[model samples]
Target: MLFIDPENTPDFKRSLFNAIVAPRPIGWISTMGPEGSVNLAPFSHFNLVSTAPPVVIFSCNAPADRHEKDSITNVRATGEFVTNLVTWELREPMNISSLDAPYGIDEFELAGLDKAPSRKVRPPRVACSPASMECKLLRIVQIEPQRPGDTVSNVVFGLVVGIHLDPAFVDPDGRFDVARTMPLTRLGGNQYASVGPLVDLARPSPRHD
Candidate 1:
């Protein structure tokens, strides 16, 4: 096996580290800008951070030149945002919204996607999404860079104040089915993957003896 140290590797090898992490969930975060402009962006470094209060986190990188991404700026200003789950059907629009559009540009309109009112957040949800989580900002933590010249990243944590699910996608068991949801996920690089075959893994019996 070949060994590589991330700190000393070339930029291409560093990117491979992200790809080797396998498929990650895409965070289709939406927020309302200071002037009420709708903003949307996709982040691969996102996941559910806690379940007790249904908290989610998405990390935004501040480039060497730019102040911050639109999604990060909007969320900080409004203290509320929406997480729209990207599905196979909405993949194209999701990709379009990821464009580095200028500030105050409405990605929703840019992508030709309809918006749905969110119950607990200032930002709206993607109308075609199978599910959405309305979140209130909990905190924004600046992650210390590992290296001297590393780019800055802010990890925004939010509590899920509400959730919206498309009734059509609900199963008889009251559970959301992955197959029906057709959720899209980020693979390394520019590749994406959709829900595939399911495998059930049951828990082992308790050792009471």
Candidate 2:
């Protein structure tokens, strides 16, 4: 196996490493205000940060102009948001929300998605999603916060307050099976993938004869 230090690599080389971490799950985050203003966006730099207290995180990278993304801003404003699972059926609509648009324009309307009121959050959840998590802002850590002219980078963390799941996608054992959900994951560039074939194995006993 080839081993190399990440710091020694060039910027593009590091970026290449990120891209090669294939088929990352997309975070279809939605946030809104008490006044009804809303924003929806996708970020591949997202995953479950923990499960004990039900925490999740998604990084809102610094924009080209060194500004934080609207998702992070709105979550900070309202202290609540929802993360909808991106499935194969909703890939096109999900992509639509990724475009840069005016802050107040509801991406749900733009994507022609139906909104369902969240049980524990102000931000309405996407009705068509297989699953969605309502979250409260735990913290927003500004990674390498800007000094005078330095570019800003930030990572937002949340504690999941509630979860909504479709009955159709639930397994007999009460688990959210990815195969049944047909979830889509993000790949490098303009690529995305659906859930692939899965295999299972049994663990061996620790006793040595």
Candidate 3:
């Protein structure tokens, strides 16, 4: 295997590395403005940052002219957002919300998605999503963008306040069964994959070496 240090390679090295880390989870974030405008978008640069406090992170890239996107703006205004898990069945509608729509346009209507009222937040949850996380904004930390004069970027960190999961996806003991959930993942540009197969490794028991 060839080892590459990003700084020593072409400018696209970092981007290539990220892409090679295939099948990253998507964060379908939904947020509402004070005027009740709703925004929805899928972010690939997302992951669970902490489990102890139930913290998650999703990167929000500013527009080309260098300003916060509607989703980021809405979250900043309301200080709350819902993260919906994209499933293979909902991929089509999920793609619709990924468009660059004008502000105040309801993505739910544009994407023809059903909105279920959130129990703890203003932004509603996608009815078709396998799972949804209601979160309160903890911080929006700015980061350097890939290109000079490109959009400003920041990873929004949130504390999960409530979790909504479909009963069918949960096991008898209340564990989320990935096999049944059928969650969708981002695989670079214009590509996606589903969760498949299972591999279990038992932890080592205490023994004298």
Candidate 4:
């Protein structure tokens, strides 16, 4: 086995970290700019952070120019956003929305996707998404730049205010059918993946003294 240190590695070599982490869920986030222009983007560095109050986080890495991504900018300005689930069927549109378009450009229009009204947020959700979460900004945590010119990362935490679920994907037992939904996920580089065969495991029961 080869050993490597991230801090000592070259800029290009550091990208291997993403691949080592394996597949990650895509956060199909949508936000409205101050002037109401919609911005849609996909972030692989996203996941649920809590369940009691329902919190999620997505990290936005600064572009090469060290500028904040439009998704983060809009979230900062409006304090609201929506996270739409990316399914196998929506993969193309989800990838299209990742384009680094100029400010004020509506990615929904660019991707030719219809917008569904969010119940608790100004930003809209993808009309065809099997599920979506309307969220209000909880806070933003910034990852300090490691080197002088290194880009920073902004982790946006949100409190889930509303959730929408398509009836077709929800099981009669009241659980979201993960296999049926076929959520899209990101792999290394330009690769993507979809849900596959699942393994079921039961947690060990508590031990008695």
TM-scores vs. true structure, each candidate: 0.94, 0.88, 0.90, 0.95
lDDT of 1 by residue, 49-138 (tens): 889979999996796558778788888998999999999888999999999988899899999999999886789999988899999999
**Every model's Cα RMSD, please?**
1.4, 2.8, 2.2, 1.4
Candidate 3 regions with alpha-carbon error over 4 angstroms: 1-15, 145-150
Please name the candidate that would achieve the greatest lDDT relative to the true structure: 4
Instruction: Point out where model 2 deviates above 4 Å.
Output: 1-14, 145-151, 203-205
- Rank candidates by lDDT, best first: 4, 1, 3, 2
Model 1 pairs whose backbones collide: none
lDDT of 4: 0.91
- Candidate with best TM-score: 4
> Where's the lowest-lDDT run of ten residues in candidate 3?
6-15
What tens digits encode model 2's per-residue C-alpha lDDT throughout 1-209? 97776545444253564578887888999999667798888888889989999999998666774267888778888889899999999999999999888668899999999999999889988899989999999988887843443356678889999999898878899998778778889877788989877888889779987
Error of 1 at 5 (Å): 1.2
Candidate 1: where is the Cα deviation over 4 Å? 10-12
